[model samples]
Each structure stands twice: as structure tokens, then as C-alpha cells.
Target chain A: MRTLYHLALSPQSRLIRLVLGEKRMEVHLRAEPVWERRDEFLAINPAGEVPVLVEDDGSTIAGSQAIAEYLEECDDTIPLLPGTIADRAEIRRLVSWFDRKFDREVTDLLVGEKVMKRFLGIGEPSSSAIRAGHANLQIHLAYIAWLAERRTWLAGDKFSLADLAAAAHLSCVDYLGDVPWDHAPEAKEWYARVKSRPAFRSLLADAVPGLRPVGHYADLDF
Target chain B: MRTLYHLALSPQSRLIRLVLGEKRMEVHLRAEPVWERRDEFLAINPAGEVPVLVEDDGSTIAGSQAIAEYLEECDDTIPLLPGTIADRAEIRRLVSWFDRKFDREVTDLLVGEKVMKRFLGIGEPSSSAIRAGHANLQIHLAYIAWLAERRTWLAGDKFSLADLAAAAHLSCVDYLGDVPWDHAPEAKEWYARVKSRPAFRSLLADAVPGLRPVGHYADLDF
Candidate 1:
């Protein structure tokens, strides 16, 4: 059986899960404390990154983008990536843009300062970092809104990996009530569609021990 | 005729030049000051990054990996990337490993502190950043050395995109006298092979107007 070694609430992990769910692929989710670097998980992913997928054929895949591509290659039906070479490249670029750039600018600050501290058994969240993350997220969401406003999906009419990538980042923030949904109604509406998906249900149900979800986290209409 | 939109001093551009030259492909080098963001270049690559290839057929390719893949697709002779899907994935992963991570930890620091300072007309280097960068460089170079000590090439036997990515970052730092070639013997030897290539001659000739080459940069035998 295929198995995924993942951390709950990790955007990349969630993105992979969403893609797998969309594909209707059956894979056992083995929650891995990526930050803890357990020896077994480290053996699987030397980078100690989350969302390492182990294929039934026994080929281990690391990197969320790589895993997604590998899954697409393994199964042809219900493609999550955009169609056409150009379109694929566009979507990949957007996915990368969010995964790397936006994560650094927005999600990271929030997660590291707020979520990580709480997980590490540290005290209260840093107000300044929270404020900074909140501000940055608004800008990021506005950009997403602009992109969402123009295309039926992030790349085009087809729901591609870009949607999963964007949702992965957004959902993490939304769980903490960090997303200013009012800033981008279209983006929020898109998030609603994304969160309602069967794949996302698993993510919504995830509880990080002491990290309680914001009241709006489980609300489909919120 | 094939044309390369490149920053002359950029080793990534140099790597592309070498690949083009090795294939005996005649390419007109069109120096693109990426920082300037000219309208023409922006139309070619919205990201405004270097090594955008404008093929004779008027098709434009962006991203180093994308350009390389296109090149491999266009011409199968003198193959750069390794064969097999797994090998291709491994090569791409390594290419990204260096291109993104190492660039941030190593290249960006040296370039920003040294290269960008001169280009942007900023005076004096940030000693603290340089000290921090040097420490980071040692760690990165050690990993490269370890990898080089084991594999025939960065990714495998074939000179893949990983080599180009590594060379791109190293060459920039080498120009700035940041690379301690004397310390990392394995990486240094690998650099010798990369540098000795006839295709690398053009790269060695690159000279930024206000910045002169560090003492040993052009000494191929060094």
C-alpha cells in the first residue's frame, strides 16, 4: 500500500493530500513529526521535510511538487495539473511562486512566530510578528484575488496544482484566523470551495495537540 | 539564429552558453541587464530572471531547468541530462536543491554583498553578512564536496542540470574570491573539469564594468 509520511497542517503535505484525494488514490497517511526528525522519517527524507510519499512499488518520493508529478505520471485520470505544455509551465511557476516566495513572505512568519512557538512549548505569540504576518497575508490574498478574479482557476479554467498549492498556504493561515477573507472575497469563495473538498476534511479534522483551531476553522460557510 | 538573453557575468548564463556551444549550436549572446527590466525582456520572461533562450524559431524558454529540458528535447545529441524517469527526477531535484536553497544561503549573500553592491552603486561590503556568508559557504561546499566525492557528476554520470546549477552559484562566488577552492579539494577538482570545458571560455571572459575579477578567478589551472 502507498503511504504518505506527513505533518498535520503542513501546506505541502496538505497539497499532496488534496491531489491524492482528487485522484481518488488510496494511501495511508502516517503522521510524521517532521520537525522532530525521527530516525525513521529522516531515513525516508534526508531533508526532514514533510509530505514524503512512499509508492506501492517502493520508490520513495520527496518534495511536494515532485510527488505531485510522480502521482500524475502513475495515474492519468483526473489530472490536477493544467493542460498543455505552456499551461503546465504557467501553473508550475505559480505553484512555485506560492510554495517558495509567498511562504517566505507570509505563511512562514505566521507559522514560525505563532504556530511553531506554541508547538515548541514556548509562551505567547509575538504580537509584532503576528501583525506583520497579518499585513503581509492581506497583500498576498489581494494578489490571489486578482489572479482568481481573472481565471476560473489560478492558471486557467482547469483546476490545476496551483489551486492546491494556493489552498495549502491559505488553509494553514485560515486555521489560525489569520486570513483577512474580507480583503479578497473571490479568494475566500475559492477557499470555501477548496476546504469543502473531501481531501481537506482530513486536514480540518487534524488537531495539533494543544493548538486549538479558531472557531471559524470548521465552518464551511465561514 | 539562436539568441541568449543573459547577464554576462551570470554563471547560469555561462552554463547555458557552454551547453549551446558544446552542441555546436550557434547562438547570438544578447546581454540583458535583468535589473533594468526592459520591456522586451519582460515580455519574454515575466520573472525577469536570467538565461532566457530565444530560439531561432522565435520560441522563448524561461527558467534554467525549463530551458535545459527544451534544449534536450530539441536536440538529443550530446545529452546533458541523465536517461530514465527516476534519473531525470533526481537531476531536477538536485538542480533545484542548489538553485533555490544554496542560492539563498551562499550565492545570494556573496552576490548581494559583493556583486549587487557594485552593480547597484552601493558602497562598501557588509562585513557581518560576509562573515555569516562564509560560515554558510563552508557548510554548503562541504555538502557539495561530499556529493562530488561520491558521484561522477553532481546528479550522475551525465553532466545534468545539477552541474550547471552548481557551477552557476560557484562561479559567481569564485569571481568574488568567496569560494575556498583550496579547502574543498573534491569540489575544486570538479570545478576544474567544468572550467576546462571549451564551452566555459566565454564565461571566463565576462567582466562587469566597475568590478574587476578577483586575483585567481580567471586562472583556469588554479
Candidate 2:
């Protein structure tokens, strides 16, 4: 069986998990405390980041994008990046948008301050960062609403990694009850559709020990 | 001819430029002052970032990774992501390592502070950030030297996108004359090899209007 080293609140880790579930691939999940910088884990991924996948043959694939591409190459039966070259480019562009831009502006601000800080014993969460996170979340959610209104899914007709990448970050933020879903109903509706998917089951059930998810986090109709 | 919207010092933009050059694709480079947040550019890329490639047909691909992957799919004649699935994963891992990690620690600090700040007219460059950037650069250079000593290229025997991504970031920092290449001879040797490639010529020749590159930035043998 394949194994995945991941963190509960890590959007990148959750993105891979969703990708695996969507692909119908079974993976043994192992929680890795990346902050400790474990030597053994570092040996597998020099980046010292989570969501590193180790195959049965001991082949290690690090980084979410790398793993996603590797999986797409290995088995394209359920392509998360489907369509023509242009279509695929749009999907990847959205994926990068969420992974990099969203992560920096919202996820890192909220999750890094709220969850990661507590786990790492870093100190109190900065209210300023949390405030900024909420403010930025509104802008992103509005963007999501715009995309949702235009396309069936985030990228296009099909449900793709773009949606997963987005939901991954939003889920992490949603876990903290930070997302103002009510204010952006269109984005909320799209997210509700994503939430009902079978692949999203495990993520909704994720409890980071001391940090319990918000009241409506697991609600499929959220 | 294809068109690429880019910033002079953006590592992401430079990565795509090198990728296009490697694939023997001719592109008309257009410098986009992303700080302006032009509504037209935002429509092409909601993220409003650089390295957005527009094809002759007006099909647009945004983001460095998306553009790189699209280029590879369009033409594999000079594949930058060569080899097996595992090998490709390794290459992508290194590419991400430099694109995300290296950029965050070094390029963003050095270039963002030194170049972007001046261009944006936000404020003066922080000496603290430049100090941290220099410190981080040494660690990354040492890591590069370690990898260079072990493999022919950063990812493996083949010179892949990993090398291009690393070089893209280092070249930006080098333009500021901040890279302490003398401290890491092996990394310097590896960079020299990348710098001498025909694909690197355009980048070497680039001179921002107000700022000049280091004396050795364009030199083949330094």
C-alpha cells in the first residue's frame, strides 16, 4: 500500500488526499510534524513539507503539484486535469492561484496564526493577521463567486484539481469558522456542491486534536 | 508569435522565459507593471501575476507552472521535463523547491525589497530583509553545491526545469550583485553552465531602465 505523510490543516496535504480519493487510490495516511524537521522525513523530502507520498516500491514523490502530475501520468482514468491544452492550462492556472495566492493571502494568515501557532507553541495568534485573513477571505470568496457564476465548476464543466486546490484552502479556513460563506452565497453554493462529494468526507472529519472544527464544517448543505 | 507578459526580476516570469527559449519557442516579451493592476491584464489572469503566455490564437496560459507544462505538452522536441514518471517527479520537486522555497526565502526578500520596492515607489529597501536574503542565499547555494556535486544537474543527469527555476531566481539576485558566488564554488560552476546556454542570453541582456546589473551578471566566465 502507498503511504502519505501529511498534516491535518495543511491545504497542500488535503489537496493530495482529495486527489487520491478522486483517483480511487488507497493511501495509508501518516501524520508528520513538519515543524520538528524530522531527519527521517527530511531524507524523503528535502523541502521538509508534508503531503509526501511513498509508494510500495519506496518511490517518494514530494510536493502536491508534483504528486498530482505524477498521479495523472501514472493513471489518467480519472484525470483531474482533463480537456484540451487550453482547458488544462486554465485548470492549472486556477490551481496555482489557490495554492500560491490564496495560501499566502488567506490560508497562511488564518491557519498559520490559529492552528499552526498553537501546535508549534509559537505564541498567541495575532489578531491583526486574523483580521487581515478575514478581510482577504472576502475578496477570494467574491472571486470564487464570480468563477462559480460563470462556470459549472471553478475551472470549467468538469470538477478538476482547481476545485480541489481551492476547497483545500477554504476547508482549512472553514475549519476555523473564518469563511464568511453567508456574504458570498454563490461561492458558498459551489463549496456546498464540493462538500457533498465522497472525496470530501475524510476532510470534513479531520479533527486537529485540540482544535475542533466549526459547527457547520461537516454539514453537507453548508 | 506568442506573447509573454512579464516583469524583469520576477523569478516566475524568468522561469517561463527560459522554458520557452529551451523549447525553441519565439515569444514577444511585454513588460507588465503588475502593480498597476490593469483591468485587461486581470481579465487574462485573475491572479494578476506575470509570465502569462498568450498564443498566436489568443489562447492564454497564466502562471509559470501552467505555462511550462503547456509548452512541454505543445512540443516535446526539447523536453525540459524529460525521463520517467519518477524522474519527472524529482524534477518538478526541485522546480517547486526553487520556485516556492528559494523565492520566499531569498528572491522575494532580495528582489522584492531591492527592485520591486524601488519600482513601486513604496519605500526604501529594508536592510534587515537584504541581510536575511543574503543569509538564506548562502544556505540555498550550499544546498545547490551539494546537489551539483552529486548529480550532473540539480534534479538528475538531464538539465531539467529544476535547473531553470533555480537559475531564474539566482539570476535575479545576481543582477543585484547579492549572490555570494565565491562562497559556493560548485553552485557557481553550475550557475555558470546555465548562464552560458543560448536560452539565457536574452535574460542576460535584460537591463531595467533605472537599475544596472552586476558586472558579472552577463559574463560567460566569472
Candidate 3:
């Protein structure tokens, strides 16, 4: 069996898990405390980050995008990046948007401050960052709504890594009850569709000890 | 001809330029002041970052990795991401190392502070950040030396995108005379080899107005 070193709340980790689930690949999950910077984990991934995938054959692939691309190449049965070269580029663009931009503006502010800090003992969450996160979330949600209104999926007519990357980040924020779904109805509708996917089941079920998810986090009707 | 909207000092933009140069692709370069947040630029890439590529057909691709991957897919003549899927994964891992981790730890602190802040008029640079960048650069340089000493190139036997991405970031810092090349002779040797390549010529010639590069920045034999 393949193994994945991940954190419960890590949007990158959740993105991979969703991708694996979508591809129907089975993987044993091991929560990695990246802050501790364990020697073995560092040996596998010198960056000390999550979403490192180790094949049963002992080959290791670190970094979420690397793992996602490797998986897409190795298994084309359920192509997450399905399209022409240009279309695939669009999907990747959105993937980078969510993974990098959205993460920096929203997830890092909310999840990083509110949750990860508590676990890592990095000091109390900053009210200013939380306020900024809320402000930024509205912008991102509006963008999502814009995309959702304009296309069948986030990238185009088909589901791709873009949707997964976005939903992954949004899901993490949703877990913390940071998302104001009512403000962006179109984005909420699109997310509800993504949330109802079978691949998203495990994520909604995720419980980071001592931090209970919001009441509607696991609700399909949400 | 394809056009690349970029900032001369941006590591991401430089990486793409190097890749394009390596592939023998000609592109009309347009320096975009991203801080100005031009509305037309935002229409193409809502994220509003540079290194956005527009094909002759008017189709566009944003983000460095997206453009790099798209170019790789469209043209296989001189493959930057060469070898097996696992091999490519390793290359991407290193690309992420420099593009994300190293950028955060070193390039962003050095070039971002010493140069970008001056251009953007974002107040004075922090001495503490410059100090931290120098400290982190040693660790990254040592890591580069470790990898260079073992492999023929940063990723493996072949010159790959990993080398380009790392060199792109280092070159920007090198332009500002922030890289402590003396501390890591092995990494310096590797960088010297990359610097001598014809693909690196344009980057060496890049001159940002109002600020001159270090004297050794354009020196192939440095």
C-alpha cells in the first residue's frame, strides 16, 4: 500500500487526499507534525512539509503539486487535468491560485493563526490577521463565484485540479467556520456540489483533536 | 511571437525566460509593474502577478509553473523536465524548494527588501530581515552544495528546470550582491556553470532602471 504523510487541516494534504480518492487510489494516512521537523521526514522531504507520498516500492515524491502531477501521469484513468494543453494550463493556473494566492491571503491567516498556532504553541491568533482573512475570503469567494458563474467548473466544462485545489482551501477555512457562505451564494452553490462528492467525505469527517468542526461542516445540505 | 509580461528581477519571470531561452523560443518581453495592478493585466490574470504568457493566438497562461508545464507539453524539443515520472517529480520538488521555500527564506527577504521595496516605495528595508536572509542563504547554499557534490546537476545527470529555478532565484539575489558565494564553493561552481550558459545571457544583461546590478552579476567567469 502507498503511504501519505499529511496533516488533518493542511489544505495541501486535503487536496491530495481528494485527488487520491477521486482516482480511487488507496493510501494509508499518517499525520505528520511538521513543526517537530523529524529527521526521517526531513530525509524524505528536506522542506519539512506535508503531502509527501511514498510508493510501496519505496520511491518518494514530496510536495503536493509534485505528487498531484506524478499521480496524474502515472494514472490517467480519472484525469484530473483532462484537456488540451491550453485548458490544462488554465486548470494549473487556478491550482496555483488557490494553493499559493488563496493560501497566502486566506488560509494562512485563518487556519495558520487560529489552528496551527494553537497546536504549535506559536502564540495567540492575531485579530488583525483574522479580520484580514475575513476581508480576503470575500474577495476569493467572489472570484470563485465569478468562475462558477462563467464556467461549468472552476477551470472549464470539466472538473479538474482547479476545483480540488480551491475546495481544499475553502474546506479548511469552512472547517474553522471562517467562510461566509451566505455572502457569496453562487460560490456556495458550487462548493456545496463539491462538498457532496464522495472524495470529500473523508475531509468533512476530519476531526483535529480539541477543535471541533462547525455544526454544518459535515452537512450535505450546507 | 509570444509575449511575456514580467518583472526583470522576479525569480519566476527569470525562470521562464531561461526556459524559453533554452527551448530557443523568442518572446517579446514586457515589464509589468504589478504593484500598479493594471486593470488589463488583472483581466488576463485575476491574481495580478507577472510572467503571464500570451500566445500569438491571443490565448493566455499565468503563473510560472503553469507556463513552464504548458511549454513543456507543447514542445518536447529540448525537454526541461526530462526523464521518468519519478525523475520529473524530483525535479519539481527542487523547483518548489527554490520557488517557494527558498524564495520565502532568502530571495524575498534580500531582493524583495533591498530592491523591490525601493522600487515600490514601500518604506525602508528591515535590517533584521536582511540578517535573517543572510543566515538562511548559508543553509540553502550548503544544501545546494550537498546536492551538487552528489548529482551532475541540481536534480540529476541532466540540466533540468530545477537548475533554472534555483539559478533564477540566486541570480536575482546575486544581482543585489547578497549571495555569500565564498561560503559554499561547490554551489558556486555549479552556479558558475549555469551562469555561463547562453540561456543566461539575457538575464545577465537585464538592467533595472535607477538601480545597477553588482559588478560581478554579469560576469560569466565569476
Candidate 4:
């Protein structure tokens, strides 16, 4: 069996888990304390980040985006990218938007301050950082609402990696109950559809030590 | 000709430019002041970042990684990525290394502080940030040297996107005269080879209006 080294609350790791689940691929998951910079783990990925996937063939794939693209190529039963080049570009664009932009503006601010700090014993969370994270969340939620109102999915008609990427970040934040879902009903409607998917089940079941998920985290109807 | 919306000093934009040059693709370059949040630009890329390519066929590709992947798929003549899946994963991982990790730890600190802050009129550059960037650069340079000593190219035998991505970021910092080449002689040698490529000519000749390249910026034998 393949093995995945990951942090439970990492959005990047969550994105891969969702992709793997959507494809019905099975892998043994190992929790990696990336902060410790373990020499053995560093041998696999010099960046010292999760999630890293080790194939049965002995090949290792590091980084979420790299793993996602690799999986899409290896398996075609469930395509995460669009068929056409133009449409695929749109999907990739949205994936970058959520993974990079949204993560920087919101997830890193909130999760970096709240969860990661605690895990690493990095001291108290900054009030300004949390406030900024919440403030940025509103803008992103509105953007999500805007996209949901126009397209069937975040990128287009197909539920591509863009949707998964966006949801992955949101799921991490949602675990902390940071998302103001009610502030963007259209986005929430779209998310509800995504949440109802079987791939999301594992993520919803994720419970970090000393950090409890929100009440509606696993609620399908929420 | 296709069009590329970019900033002259942006590493992400530079990576796309290098890829375009490698493919021998002609493109109209449009300098975008993303700080202004231009309405027209935002329509093309909600992320409002550079290196957005608009095709002659009216298809638009945003984000450097997305654009690079799209270009590779669309044009295979000068393949910047290796053929095998595992090889490709290694290439992608290194690309992510330079683009995400290096950019965050080094380029962003230097370029973001010195150039972008001035462009956006975001106040004076922090001395501490510049010191931090220089400190990080030494670590990355050593890593680059380590890889160069082992492989023909950063990824493997083939000169892949990994090389281009690393060069793109280093070029920006080099332009700022921040890279201490003597510290990592092997890495410097590798960079010289990447710089000598015909595709690197445009980047070598790049001169921002108020910001000039370093003395050896366009030097092939540097």
C-alpha cells in the first residue's frame, strides 16, 4: 500500500486526502511533525512539509499540487481537471486562487496563529492576526458567493480540483468555526453540495488533539 | 501574438517569460500595476496577480504554474519537463521549492521589501527583513549547490522547469544585487549555465524604469 505523511489540519494535506478519497485510492496515513524537521522525513522532502506521498513502487511525490497533478495523470476514472485546455486553465487558475491567495490572506492568518502556534509551542496567538483572518474571510466568502452565483462549481460545470482546493482550505478553517457561512448563502449552498460528497467524510471526521471541530463540521445539512 | 500581463521584477512573471521564450512563443508584454486593483485586470484574474497569459484564441491562463503546465501541454517541442511520471514529480517538487519555498523565505523578503513596497508606496524597507532575506539566501544557495553537485540539472539529467523556476527567482534578487554568488560557487556555476541559454536573453536584458540590473546581470560569463 502507498503511504502519506501528513498533518491532520493541513489544508494542503486535506486537499490530497479528498482527491485520494474521490478516486477511492487507499493509503496509510502517518502524522508528520513537520516543525521538528526530522532527518528521515527531510530525506523524503527537503522542504520539510506535508503531505508527502510514497508509492509502493518506491517513488515519492511531495507537495499537494504536485501530488494532485500526479494523481490526475495516474487515474482517469474520476477526472479532477476539465477536458478542454481553456477550461482546464480556468480550473488551475481557481486552484491557485484558493491555495495561494486565500490561504495567505485567511488560512495562514487564522490557522497559523491558532492551531500551528499551539502545535509548535510558538507562544500565544496574536489578536491582530486573528482579527485580520476573520476580516479577510468576509472578502473571500463574498468572492465565493460571486463564483457560486455564476458557475455550477467554483471553476465551472465540473467539480474539478478548484472546488476541492477551495473546500480544503475552508474545511481547515471551518474546523475552527472561522467561516461566516451565513454571510454568504450562495457560497454555503455550493459548499453544502461539496460537503455532502463521500470524499469529505474523512475530513469531517478529523479531530485534532486539544482542538475540537465546530458543531456543524460533520453535519451534512449544515 | 499572445499577451502576458506581468511586472518586470516579478519572479512568477519571469518564470512564465522564461517558459514562453523556451517555447519560442511571441507575446505582447503588458506591465500591470496590481496594487491599483485595476478593474479590467481583476476581471481576467480575480487574484490580481501577474503572469496571466491571454491566448490568440481568447483563452486566458492565470498563475505561473498553471500557465507553465498549459504551455507544456500545448507545446511539446522544447520540453522543459522530463517524460517519466516519477521524473516529472521530482521536477514539479523542485519547481514548487523555488517558487513557493524560496520565494517566501528569500525573494519575497528582498523584492517585496525593496521593490514592491516602493512601487506601492508602502513606506520604507525594513532593515530586519533585508537581513532575514540575506540569511535565508545562504541556506537556499547551499541547497542549490547540493543539488547541482548531484544532478546534471536541478531535477535530473534534463534541464526542466525546476531550473527555470530557480533562475527566475534568483534573477529578481540578482537584479537587486542581493545574491552573494561567491558564497556558493557551485550554485553560481549552475546559474551561469541557465543564464547562458538563448531563452534567458530577454530576462538578462530586462531593465526596470527606475531600477537597474546588477553589474553582472546580463553577463554570460558571470
Candidate 5:
């Protein structure tokens, strides 16, 4: 069996988990507190990040994008990336948008300050940072709405890693009950379709011991 | 001819430039002030970032990783990524290491505070941020030395995009003369090898009008 070392609220980890499920690959999940700088985890991934996947053959794959591409190479069953070079580029561009742009502008500010800080004992959450996160979230949601209104999925007609990546980040923030779903109904509708997928079940069931997700987080109609 | 929208100091842009050069692809470089959020540039990449590549057919690829993968898919002549699935994973993992981890901890701090701030006219650079960038850089250099000491190349036997990504970030910072080369001899040796490649010529020759690079910036012997 393969194993995934991950953090519950981590968007990166969430993204990988979603990818694995989409690929229909079963993986034993272990919650790793990376901030502790565990030597074992560090040995697995020198970068000390979560969502490091170790195969039954003892081969290890680190980094979400690396793992995502590796899975695509290993199996083409559910094809998260669309065909054609141009379409693939668009999918990857959106993936980077969510992974890098959204992560920096939104997720880090919100989750880094609100959730991870407490877990790592890194002091109180900054109100200003949270405020900025919400502001950025609005802009990103609008962007998502813009895409959803036009394309069937975030990337195109096909359900791709672009949708997975965007949903993964949104899921983490939504868990904190921070997403302005009402303000961006089109984006909300798009997310609802994604959330109904079989891959998202495990994520909806995810619970962080002391911290609770939003009330409507698991609700399909929310 | 292909076109690359980039900023000379951007690590992501530098990575793409190196990859393009390594693949023997000719590109006309256009310096883009991304912070200005030029509508024309925004149309190319909504993320408002640089290193967006436009093909002769007008097909566009945004994001460094996307562009790199696109290049690999399009042409395998130089084959910056290795042969096997495992090898490719390792290369990409290291590429992510440099692009995300190294950039966040080092490049963004140093370059963001120094060069980008100047270009954006966003006030003075913070001394503390620069101090932290240098501090984080030492650890990264030591890690590079560790890898170089053990492997024939950063990701394994063949020179891959892993090396290009790492070297790209280092080169950008090195331009500002912030790299402490004396502390990591093995890393410097590896960089020297990368620096001597013909593909690196364009990057080495890069010069920003008002802010000049260090005297040894383009010198392969240094």
C-alpha cells in the first residue's frame, strides 16, 4: 500500500489527496505536524512539507505538483489534464494560479494565521492578515465565477487538475467558513458540482480534533 | 520566433529563460512590469506575473512549471527531465524545492525587497528582510552542497530542469552579489559548471540599466 503524509487543513495536502482519489489510487493517510521538524518526515522530504507520497515499492514522491504529474504519467484513467498542448497549458496555468497565486494572496494569509499558527503555537492570529485574506478571497472567487460562468469546469469542459487545485484551496478556506459563497454564486455552483464528486467525500469527512469546520461545510445544498 | 514576457530579476522568469536556452529555443525577451498590471500583459496572464511564453502560432503558456513541462513535451532533444518515472519525479521535486521553497525563503525576500521594490517604486527595501534572505540562503546553499557532493547532478546523473531551476534562483540573487560563495565550496563548484554552459550566456549578460550586477556577475571563472 502507498502512504501519504499530510496535514488536515493544508491545501497542498488536500490537493494531493483529491488527486489520488481522482486517480482511484488508495493511500494510507498519516497526519504529520511538519512544524515540529520531525527527523523522520524530513528524511522523507527534505523540504519539511506535507503531502509526501511514499510508494509500496519504497519510492518517494514529494511536492504536490510533482506527485500530481507522476500520477498522471503512471495512470491515464481519469485524465485530470485535458488533451492538446494548449489546453494542457491552460490547465497548468490555472493550477499554478491556485497553487501559487491564490496560496500566497489568500490561503497563507487566512489559514497560516488562523489555523496553523495555533497548531504550531506561533502566537495569536493577526487580524490584519485575516482581513487581507478575506479581501483576496473575494477577488479570487470573482475570478472563479468568471471561469465557471464561461467554461464547464475551471479549466474547460473537462474536469481537470485546475478544478481540483482551485477546489482544494477553496475547501480549506471554506472549512474555516471564510468563503463568500453568496457573493459569488456562480463560483459556488461550480464548487457544489465538484464537492458532489466521490473524491471529495473523504475531505468533507475530515475533522481536526479541536478545531471544527464550518456548519455547512459537508452539506451538499449549502 | 517565440516570445517571453519577463523581468530580468524574477527567479521564475530566469528559470524559463534558462530552460528555453537549454532547449535551444530562440525567444525574444520583453521586459514586463507586472506590478503595473498592464492590461495587455494581464490579457496574456491574468495572474499578472512574468515568464509567459508565446509560441509562433500565438499559443500561450503561463507559469514557469507549465512552460517547462510544455517545453519538455514539445521537444525531447536535450531532455532536461530524466528518463524514468521515478527520475522525473525526483527532478520535479527538486524543481519545486527551488521554485517554491527556495523562492519563498530566499529569492522573494532578497529580490522582492531589492529589485522588485525599486521597479514598482514601492518605497525603500527593508534591511531586516534582506538579512533574513541571506540567512535562509546559507541553509539552501548548504543543502545544494549536500546534494552536489553526493550526486553527479542535482537530481541524479543527467543535468535536468532541477539544476536549471536552482541555478536560476541563485543566479538572480548572485546578480545582487548576495550569495556567500565561500561558505559552500561544493555548491559554488556546481554553479560554476552551470554558469559555464552556453545556455547561461544570455542570463549572464543580463544587465538592468540603473542597478548593475556585481563585478563577477557574468564571469564564469568567478
Candidate 6:
């Protein structure tokens, strides 16, 4: 058995958890409040970011993508990533988009707009930034919808890490009711497939104390 | 021959250019003004970002990382990236550090203070953000120097993608005389080695019209 040190509410942590759950490997989920910065946790990861995995060999893996790749290599039986070179590139691209662009333009924006004010002690939300974030989301969501319509999964027919990355960020946005699911049936369906899996149960149950959940936060149908 | 859509001033685009040069692959370099969008550029990359490589097969690869991976697949002799899984993960983590973390903290601040103000017709710059960016750079360069002292290259012996990622963003920051090169001699030596390459030649010549070049902009040994 391995151990995963991560924040309960983080999409990346949950994504990694889902992958491990799918593989039926036991991973002790240890909560690490990265923002609070425990000294031991900082030593494990100088970046102080979560989704850090301690493997059986005592080697530590930080960064969700790195951890996911390490796991895929540890056991290739249930490949969460693609095999061929081109397939791998495509999967990496999609994973990066959700991790970078979607995370920046969508997830980052939503979190900053709807969440960061209370967290940062920055007086009241910046309405201009929030509006800009929403506008950016509109564009990103459209592009995602277009991508979803063309493929069964995000990168291709097989379920890959790309889907997990997307679901992770989208899940957070969804929790805030910030995602425009009605406008993107394709994206919605894609998420539904990811959501229905038993592995997603832990992710869906997560809650942050002061930040109240949206009306449909726990509703499976929503 | 592949065609690379690049902005000469952009380090990400320059890194791809460097790789292409190292591989001796003939790539038609199209110097695009990314800020002012064009239809053709949009057709190639939905994100409207630079370093889009249009492969000979007419398939386009967007994202510097994705484009770099696609190019690596085409040719491996030069080996711009690591081969082993663990090493590659390390390389990718470092690459992400500069591309994401540095971008958000250092580059964004400097660019906002130096570049964005000019772009938006905002006079002068925010003195506070520039000071903050400088303070942040002091810390980042120290880390780079620390890492350089321990390894032959950023990730390890091989000059992997991590080098290009660091140089790309740093080069942009350097253009504004933001890099405290004298503060980190090891990092300075690394930069000199990287900048001296034929691939970096084009990058060194970039000039943002209204902004005067940093006094030592193209001084190779400096």
C-alpha cells in the first residue's frame, strides 16, 4: 500500500484517488492542508503543493501529473494513459489544457472570483475580475464542448488521464455551480460518466468549512 | 519541413526553435504578432498562443510543451527531453515550475509592470509590482543557482526540456533587465551556454518597438 498526502477538496488529489481506486490499489489518504503549510509537508514538497504520493519504495512523487505518470509506470496493467507516442502527446496536451488553460481561464477564475476573496482577506470580490473570469469561462467551455463532441473521451476512445484532469477542475467549478452544464450537454455527459464511477464518491463528499456549497453540491443528478 | 508559428520575443517559441535547430530540421519560422490576433493564427491554435508547430502532415500542435513533445517524436537523436520515466517527470516538473509558478509570481508581475502597461496605454508602470517582481526574482534565481550547483543540467546530466522552459521565461524577463544575472553565477553560466546556441540566436535579436533594449541585451558574455 502507498500513501497520498493531499488536500481533500483539491481536484488533483481526487483525480489521483480515482485512478488508484480504479486500479484497486490501496492508498492511505492523508490530509495535507498545503495553504496552512505544515513544516513536515513543506519538507516533502518544497513547492508546498498537494497531491504528493509516497510510493512503497519510499520515493516521494509530487505534482498530480508526475504522480499519475509514476503510477502508470509502476503497473501498466490498467493503463490510465495512452500507449503509442502520438496518443501520449494528445493525452498530455489535453491534460495540460485542463491543468493549465482550463485551470487558468476557468478553474482559476472561478476560484478567484467566487472563492479567493474570503481566503486571501482581500477586501470584497473584484467584480471586474469576476466578470472577466465568467467571460473567459464562456469561451473555454465552448472550446471544451467542441472537443467533447468529437471524441468519446477527452483525448480519444479510451478513458485517459486527460479525462481525470478535466473532471477534477470541472468538479470544483461544478461544486460552486459555476459551470454552465446546460449549455454543454456534451461536456455534461462526459462529466456524468466520470461522476457515476464509485471512485468519484470520495471527491463528491468533500467540503470546505466556511465556503458554503452550492444548492446542487451533493445532488448526484445535479 | 515543418512550419513554426512563433513570436521571436517569446521564450517558449524560442525553445522550440532551439530544439528545431538542434535537430537540424528545416522549419519555416513565421514571426507572428500574437497580441494582435489574425484569422490564420486562430485557425492554427484556438488559444491564440505562440510556438504552434504545423507538422508536415498538416496536423498542428499547440502549447510549447505539446509542440515540443510532437517534435521530439519526429526526431530523437538530439534528445531535447529526458527518456527515463522518473527523469522525464523531474524535467516536466521543473518545466511546469517555470511555466506556471514563475509565470504567475515573477513573470506576470514584471510583464504587468513592464509590458502590459505599454500594451494597454497605461503610462509608466506600477512601481510596487516591479519591486515585488524583483524581490521574487531574487528568490527564484537563488533556487536555480542551488539546483545548478547540484546537477550538470536543470533536471540531470541531459540538457532536457527543463532548461528550455527556464530559459524561455527568463529570456523574456531578461529583456526588461529584470534578471539579476550577477546574483547567481551558476545560473548565469547556464544561461550563457543556452544563449550561445544557434537556436537562441534568433531570440537574442528580438526588439519590442517602443521599449528600448536592456543596455546589455545581446551581450553574450555578460
The digit string of per-residue lDDT tens for model 1 on A23-91 reads 989889998866576798777766677778887787787878667867876676898764766566667
Full candidate order by lDDT, most accurate first:
3, 2, 5, 4, 6, 1
Q: Give the TM-score of each candidate.
A: 0.85, 0.98, 0.99, 0.98, 0.99, 0.90
By TM-score, the better pick of 1 and 2 is 2
Residue B175, model 4: Cα distance from true site in angstroms: 0.5
**TM-score per model for chain B alone?**
0.91, 0.98, 0.98, 0.98, 0.98, 0.90
Q: For candidate 3, what's the RMSD?
A: 0.8
Model 1 off-target regions past 4 Å? A56-58, A117-130, B1-81, B117-126
Write down the DockQ of candidate 1: 0.31
Give the DockQ (2 decimals) of all models. 0.31, 0.93, 0.91, 0.80, 0.86, 0.47
Rank the models by DockQ, top first.
Answer: 2, 3, 5, 4, 6, 1
Error of 2 at A203 (Å): 0.8
Q: B164 in model 5: Cα distance from truth in Å?
A: 0.3
Residue A11, candidate 1: Cα error in Å is: 1.9
Show where candidate 5 strays beyond 4 Å: none
Model 3 reaches an interface RMSD of 0.4
Sliding window of 10 residues with minimal summed lDDT for model 4 chain A: A82-91
C-alpha RMSD over true interface residues, each candidate? 2.8, 0.5, 0.4, 0.7, 0.6, 2.1
Q: Judging by lDDT against the true structure, name the best candidate.
A: 3
Candidate 6 positional error at B112, Å: 4.6
Q: How close to the true structure is residue B136 of candidate 1, measured as C-alpha lDDT?
A: 86
Residue-level error in angstroms, candidate 2, position A45: 1.1
DockQ winner: 2
lDDT of 6 by residue, B1-222 (tens): 778998756667877887787777888988877767788898878677887888788877787777777778778888876667777777767877787778877887897668866765668988888888889888889988988999988888988888888888888898888888998999999888888877777678888777766887788988
Question: What would the DockQ be for model 4?
Answer: 0.80
lDDT of 3 by residue, A68-185 (tens): 9999999989999998999999999999999889999999999999999987888999999999999999999999999899999999999999999999999999998889999999
